[model samples]
Target: MIPLAMLAQFRALHHHLLRLIDGLDDAEYRRQYHPDLSPAGWHLGHCLWVENHWLRAVVLGDDRTTRHDARYYQPQYSPKPERGARLPPRDAQLATVAAGFEANILLLADQDQRLDPTHPLMTDHYLPLFLLQHHSQHLETLRMVMTQRALSRHRHAFHPQARLRATPVAHETVSLEAGDYPIGGAAPKAFDNELAAGNARLEDDTIALRPVSNAEYLGFIESGGYDNPALWDALGRAWLDDHPVEAPDHWRRDGRGWWYGIGLEGPHELEPRAAVHGINLHEARAFARWAGAHLPHEFSWETLARQGRLSLAGQAWEWCDNAFFPYAGFKPFPYLEYSTPWFDGTHYTLRGASRYTPAHTRRPSFRNFHTADKRHIFAGLRLAF
Candidate 1:
C-alpha cells in the first residue's frame, strides 16, 4: 500500500494544480495561449491521463482507460493547436480528471505485492514524488499560458502598481579555471535526461555572475539590435526576417515605454535590474553577439551551478549553447518518449531551475530543453566569454 504520507502529497499536488484554474471561466479555460502550448483543459485532462498511466495502469496493472479516452490524450493525437478541438467537452474533461484521481487513490490502496521492483516508481518508492514533479511542470506551463493570454487580451487582470521583483546586481564576468569536471549528478529523483553521468573537459572561460537584466537588454533593443542582420546568425536572421520580432515575447509596450509581462501578477513597468526572460535562444545569441559576449555552454554554466555562484533558488532558467544531445553512454529510462524525441538537434539545452521549478527536482545536474525558436517557457540569458 502506498504510505499515507505519499498519498497525501499526491493529493496535495493534484489539488494545487486544479487550483490554478479555479477562478477562470469556460472561455478562459479553453483558450490556447499559444500555437504550441496546450489549453488549460487539456493540461488538466493530460495530467490525469499521465497519473492513470503510471500509478494505476503501470503500477497496479489496471488498463481500463485505454479503450475509451487514452488515445485522445496521447501526444501524437493532441498536438497543441488541435487539442481544443480534439478534447471532450469541458464538463466531460473535468469529470475525467476527477475520476482519474479517484482511480489513483484506489490504486494506491491496493497494496499489490506483484509490482515490479525495477519499475521507475518502485525503484526507490518515488512513484508519487515523480507524479508530483510532473504535475508541477504542467502547472507552471499552464501559468505561463494563462499569463500570456492575460497580457494579450485583458491588461486589467494585472495589478496596476508594480510588484516587488528580483533586481539585477552589478554583474561581472568571473573566470572559471576549467578542467575535466564530472557533469550530471546522482540525485535519486533525477529524470532520465540527467542520467548516464559523463565528464567534460571544458576550457577556462569567464562567466556571468547573474542573468542579463531588463536594463542591459533594453540597451540592445533601443540600439536597433533587432533590425541589424550582422548581429544575428544566418538562421536567426532568416527567423527574424520571417517573424520580424522587435523585442522579447514577454515585453509589452505602451504610449510611454516597454514594460515586462508577469503572468497573473500583471504587467509592471520595466525594471532595469530584473532579469529579462521570455526570450528565445536566437534573441539571446544575438544579444550576446552585440555585446561581444557568448552564451555559456551547458558545462560552463553547470560549473557555476556546482559552485553555487549564482542565486539559483528561484531564478528563471538560463539558455546554454548546447543542443539537447544524449551523453556518451545513454540509455532511455522506462519512458523512451520523454527524452528521445527531443534529441533531434533542433532544441537547445536550458540549464538552471525556474521560479516555478519544484524544489525537490532542483539540482545542478537538471537539464531542461526546448526548440530554439520557442520562448514562452520561463527562460532567460546568461553570458560566458
Candidate 2:
C-alpha cells in the first residue's frame, strides 16, 4: 500500500504541474514544438482527461459520463471541428485540474480501508495517483518548450546537434551476464540509500560501442524493413498499419535529400554511424527480426553496462527487450507510487546512462523503461542474437 506521505507527494506534484502553466495565454497555449507533443493547452487538459476517464468513468463505474469533453480539450492536429477554444476557457480547464487534485487526496484518505490493492489503477497508482506522476513529467516538456519559444531568437545557438558532428565512437562491445533486472528510477532520494546499502547492481552484457547509426538504420528501412510482416509481432503489425515509419522520429525528405533534427540545424544530413535512435521498440524489434536477431533483455544489457567496458555512460543510453519490473525481494520505497505499478505491463527496458542522465544517476543496476511506442525521449536500442 502507498504510504500517506507518498500520496501527499502525488498531490504536491499536481500543484507543481499547475504552477508551470500558471499564466498561459492563447498564443502561448497554441504553440506547437512538434506534432507528437500535445499543445500546452491540450497537455493541460489531458492531465484532467485521465482523471475523468479513469476515476469518474472507470473507477467509479459511471459509464455514462462523457469523457470526450476531455478530448475536446486535446489540442491535437486531427482538426478541432469546433475551433477557437478547444478548452473550457482557461478557468474551466484549471478548475478541472484543481478538482482532480482534490479528489486524489480524498482517494488517498480512504485508500487504507476501502481501496483495492489489486486494482489496475493502484497497480500503477490508479488513475488519480498516476495523474500526479504523469503531469509532473509533461511539465518538463512544457517548460522546455516555453523556454524555447520565449528564446526563439537564440534557437540557432542552443541546439545540441549543431555543436557536434557524427564523431567516431571510442568504446567497443561491453558484456555482462544475463538475468532479470529491476528497471527505472529509485525513490526520490533512494539513490543515496541504494549506494550506501550496496543494493544497486550493474551488469556488463556486451553492448554496441556506438548507437545504431542513421545510415545503418536507413539500410533497414530501404530493405522494406517496415513492410516485412515476418519482422513484426501482432501489435507491431498494427502499429505499422497506421504509421508509415522511415528512418527515425523527426525525419523528413527535402527534394532529393533526407535529413532530421539532431536537436538543431533545421534538419541536417543524416549520419550513418551515430546510433539509430528515435525508433520505437516495434521498429527496433522489426529490424532485429530481419537481421536474424532479437532485442537484448535487461539482464543481458545490464551485464554489458556493469562491465564498465563500454563508454555508453557517455555516448548514449541503449534499449533492451526486457520490461521494467522490481527486482526479487524488492519492496516499495518511500513514494511507492513510482515503479512498482508498471511491472505487469509491456514497458520496454533500457540500460546505461545518456548525457542527460546525471553522473550520480549512472549505475549498472539502474533500469529505465517506457512504453514501446515512445520515441520522443533520448532513447536508442542495441541488437543481440
Candidate 3:
C-alpha cells in the first residue's frame, strides 16, 4: 500500500502549486512570460497529464482517454512558444486539473490495482514519489515564470523597508585532500542521471566555502568583465555578442543604485551577502576567470557537499565546469526522454539548491543541468583553485 506520508506530501505539493497561481487572472494564467516557459495554466494541465500518462496508463495499464488534451499538454506535440495560445480557458483548465488530482489520489489509494509487488514503479511506492518530485520541480518553474511576468509588466509592488542591506563577502576557502570519492549512489528517490553508484578521482583542490556573493560579482561588473574578451570562451563570446547583457537578468537601474527584481514583489536592492544568481554558465565562468579561478568540477563539488563542508543548502544553484553526462553505468528509468535526451555535451551541470528549490529536491547528488547561455535558472558560481 502507498504510505500515508507519501500521499500527504503529494496533497501538500498540489496545494502549493494551486497557491502559486492563486491570484492570477485568466490572462496572466494563460500568458507565457518567458520564451522558454509555458503558461501557468499549461503547467497545471501538463502535471495532470503526466499523472494520467505514468500512473494510469503505464502502471495500471488503463488505456482510457486522458483528462487533459495531449496536443497542448504533451511537450513534443506543442512547442513552447505556441503552448500559451493552445491552453484552454482558465476555469475549464483548473476544473480539469482539480478533478484529475482527486482521481489520482483515489487511484493511489486503490491498493488492489496500483500497489502490485511485482510492478517496478509500485515497489517501494516509487511512482508516487516520482510524481511528487515532478510536481515540485514545476512549482519552481512557475515561480520563475511569475518573476518574468512581473518584470515584463513593470509591476513594482516592492516596499521600501524590504530592501536588503549589503553584507560582507567572506573570502574563506576549504582545502580538500582529494582521492577516489563516491559519486552517484543507488537511491530510490534519485533520478536516473544520479544513479549507478560509482567513484570519481580528483586531485587535491581548494574550493570556496560558500558561493560567490553579489558584491564580488558586482566588482567583476565594475572592472569591465563583460567588455574583456579574454574572460570568455568562444561559445561565451558568441552568446555575449547576441545577448549583449551587461549584468544579470532581472536587474534594473534608475536614480537609485543597482536593484534586482524579485518574483511578484518587484525590484529590491541587491543583497551583497546572498549568492549571486541569474547568471548562466558563460557568465559564471567569466566571473571565475576574472578572479583568476575556475568553476569547480562536479566531482569536487559533490565530494565537498557530501562531507558537509559546503554551505550550499538553500543557497543559489552553483555551476560546475563539467558538462552534464550520464554516470558510468547509466541507464534510463521509466522513460528515456527525461535524462537521456539532455546528455549532449552542450549542457553544463549545476549543484546545490536555489532558495526557491523545494526541500525534497535538495540532496547533494541531485543534478541540475542547463545550456551555457540560459541564465534565468537562479544559477550562480563558486571558484576552485
Compare the candidates by lDDT and give the number of the best one. Answer: 3
Note the clash tally of each candidate: 2, 30, 0
1 against 3, candidate with superior lDDT: 3
Cα lDDT for residue 363, candidate 3: 83
lDDT of each: 0.76, 0.58, 0.82
Worst 10 residues of 1 by lDDT: 160-169
Q: Write one digit per residue (lDDT tens) for candidate 3, span 4-117.
A: 887788788888887777678899998988887888988898898889988877777774746447566778788888887777788887777887888888788775564465
| C-alpha positional error of residue 222 in candidate 2 after TM-score superposition, expressed in Å | 1.6
TM-score of each: 0.90, 0.55, 0.94
Regions of model 3 farther than 4 Å from truth: 111-114, 155-170
Tell me each candidate's RMSD, in Å, in order: 3.0, 9.4, 2.2
lDDT of model 1 at position 115: 60
Residue-wise lDDT of candidate 1 within 101-149, one digit each (tens)? 8767666655655566677667766676677777878877887877777
Ranking by lDDT: 3, 1, 2
How good is model 1 by TM-score?
Answer: 0.90
Q: Residue 299 of model 2: what lDDT? A: 61
Cα shift from native, residue 368, model 3 (Å): 0.7
